[model samples]
Target: MTQHQAADTVVIGGGQAGLAAGYHLRRLGIDFVVLDAQAAPGGAWQHTWDSLHLFSPAAYSSLPGRLMPPQEGETYPDAAHVVDYLTDYEQRYALPIVRPVRVEAVHRDGTHLRVETGAGNWRARTVISATGTWWRPFLPAVPGRADFKGIQLHTVEYRSPADLAGQRVIVVGGGNSGAQIAADLAYETDLTWATLREPRYLADDIDGRALFDHATARRRALDEGRSDTGGVASLGDIVAVPPVRTARDAGLLKAQPMFTRLTATGVEWPDGTRADADAIVWCTGFRPALSHLAPLGLRGPRGHLLTTGTQAIGEPRLHLLGYGDWTGPASATLIGVGRPARDAARAIAALLGNA
Candidate 1:
């Protein structure tokens, strides 16, 4: 079609990773366009709960070129602050971003990859898929889950504690979201936190910044042909953010083993103990939102596309960004995405002979 519709590189999902890729592509003087599914500028940040807060400070949580401005009267910026920063970063660079376009699939079209979207089609020599995991909420298959009569929701559907306040609620999973949401609802509801195992809490001094640093060091070690010193996953599951720490110190953050099954009223443990509940909120986590790439046939058994660096191993012309450490260490976080984004852009630029 029109020249405006095609570029040397096309970035899918204009969130933190896409924006970071855009910044580097611009710096490298490569022609590219970013396609975003959302009607607005903020990516998944716009969809987070009102109380969600970054584990790191504003200075640590930022995209490539611009530092996220600190939130007023806040150390760790909240969801709204992150949204504002992402929106501002998108505008400041004037990156050519087309919005409200849902990409249906990506297909191999001869030498170029064709990105099929509801809006139209675009062909590019290289495609970067930054569609983060936010959209694909993973709910574990629990027996009798469908039979549960009370309200059941994933982290994505949760908004305010007032919505489930004063009710018997069980929060599932042991990740950061589980801890944070559990903390938020501890006193507000008759809350029960359930995890697959004992939750690991990092020292209060360790936050996202420390995790990012450790990831960087691990990447360096790997690149240097040294043994992986281990990344954040080696540390702990929870960061012990202010609220989580408060809850833990107050003896409110006790977590029981994940229930073996869901009963009509609530849940039952392996010991046959049961708890009645009005609602169950799952902070179980998410999988990569890669349905668009199904046409490419690159996914492995674990449901992740094989990649070396950010480039898809099976599809050389395609790259995956910000799905998590598989793309790059800490790549899912705001600060951790830049390195991989830059690497992906540089690889694309070199491939296109534009570097």
Candidate 2:
């Protein structure tokens, strides 16, 4: 049942990044196909928790060519709205996406990159690895993690507060996800939010639009050889999204210092304080989903590819998109992804002698 397909360029992942690259590829008349592991469109957005909302308005969080249509009566769209937008974007652009084809590995085959997938294989002059970080959720290895008898889960496995209703739950990590999830569980559960350090909240007015602007300015300053202008991180750790703001105002979003270890029943701090919990939710973030590219021998000590912009330094024919700022400033966001995707597509076109 395995067959071989060929394209001048192969774009791995059909999510926002992949779709953005596809739009540019189509514009440039590049012969390429997008390979998505998902059974349908929407990509990782389909899997987010029910209560999750964007950090900005729909227009501010759009993809390459089209703006995500605003959800009715909502300033910030929820996860389901994002899914609908992504699904519609795929159809609007008519990007050639092969579904449910998980890429297992990518190997160098002579002058071409051979993308091995569950459904088939693709041979391409160039490959764009846009398979983003959602597949690789990171859970910190706290001491006694294995001994913890209570329920444990990462943000990826979390769906809705209903799943943990009435439980004494500890939500871990200081990032946006941790804050949001803790907010989601605030009313439904006995919630304890924990962070490695004190949580930093941005100005109440600051949202994804402001973050994107700051990130763009930082990138501009870097490119112009000026002193670092600073990006989103320069402001604060968490954007005061609506739910998070409400939770904070209600005194339900207070964060505790991260516990040193997990016990069979709960977690304990170095100060000899212990709190019992029915479950632990790890909002600890994720690593880049780059396991498929391991065969290329490109990752470094920290398990990240060295890149000149979006193109891999060790492998020029291979490009990475939408991981984080290293790929491109704010490249992981919907609006942020378009710039890098275009750059990647243009690079592939130039490499293939089409540009």
Candidate 3:
């Protein structure tokens, strides 16, 4: 039951990045359509753990043309609130989004890019791929990892502390997810935090506003051809959200260096000390979900497309948005994504002579 559809521009993904690009394209009066793989709105935010919250406040973490409604008396918005906000944003603009259309490939079809999907295919003058990294969770291949008999899952599969109640758990990685999840489970269960190196724990008061300002300044420095300050904290660093702050206050934020290998029952340290655990939660990050664009032969090292302000340098018809600083400074966050999305939209419009 596959059919072929056509659009002046095709935007892949329906998350914050895709929606922002859609807003800009609509403003330009472009005949663009957004293709979302998810059955519903909210994108990857819908898939995060139940207790997860944004490190940024509502005002600072928003897409273009709209603001995320603030959580009641909370410094950070929970994951559900973000989902609701994204859903509302999609409905508010009446953006043209095709649901449940999992794009399988995007390749050359003469001058246009052919977007192959499960439901149908799209022929577009240009394509904007805003698919973020959640779907491709990265787990290092540790020795004896497969032999572990205990439960093991990445943060993507984690939902609640209830699912992991009372188990001796090892939480791995130094990012926000690892810190938050460890903090959540540390009080409920026996948990150990593991990182390759000591984590940079930003002050509990430092939130997304401070990080955004730093990101803006970094971008400004790059623009001015000046050396970066190299002092501002990165978003990747652990921010002390309430739960994490409480855990840190309780002496639970201490982390052990990563174990050398996994044991059938647990993990083994370099000194041969074995830590027994009922399960392991890998808070390791993700790679870009760009399997659809394999046919273009444009993916460079690390499977990332080199872009000049959102437009792919190797493939002129392709643009990547919201993957992170590669596309734009802080482009992965809600507030930081708008600029890259606008630049992507403008580039596509200009290419199609519709600008």
lDDT of 3 by residue, 1-355 (tens): 5567999899999999999999999999999999999999999999999889998889889999998889997878998899999999999999999998889999898888899988878999899999999989999989999999999999999988899898999999998899999988987788999999898789878888888778878988988999976635543478888998898888988999999999889999999999998999999999999888889888787988877888888788899999988888888999999988888888878889942
lDDT score at residue 98, model 1, on the 0-100 scale: 94
Q: Is candidate 1 or candidate 3 better by lDDT?
A: 1
Write candidate 2's Cα lDDT for 1-355 as tens digits: 5567999999999998999999999999999999999998988999988888999999999998898888999999998999899899889988999998899999999988999998878999999999999999987878999999999999999988999999999999999999999999999999999999999999999999999989999999999999997678879999999999999999999999999999999999999899999999999999999999999999875668999999999899999999999999999999999999899988988999942
Model 3 — which ten-residue stretch has the worst lDDT? 228-237
Question: Which segments of candidate 3 are over 4 A away from where they belong?
Answer: 1-3, 231-236
- Candidate 2 accuracy as TM-score: 0.98
Error of 2 at 96 (Å): 0.4
Question: Which pairs of residues clash in candidate 2, taking residues 3 or more apart in a chain or in different chains?
Answer: none
Q: CA lDDT, every prediction? A: 0.92, 0.93, 0.89
TM-score (C-alpha) between model 3 and the true structure: 0.97
- Ranking of models by TM-score: 2, 1, 3
Residue pair clashes in candidate 3: none
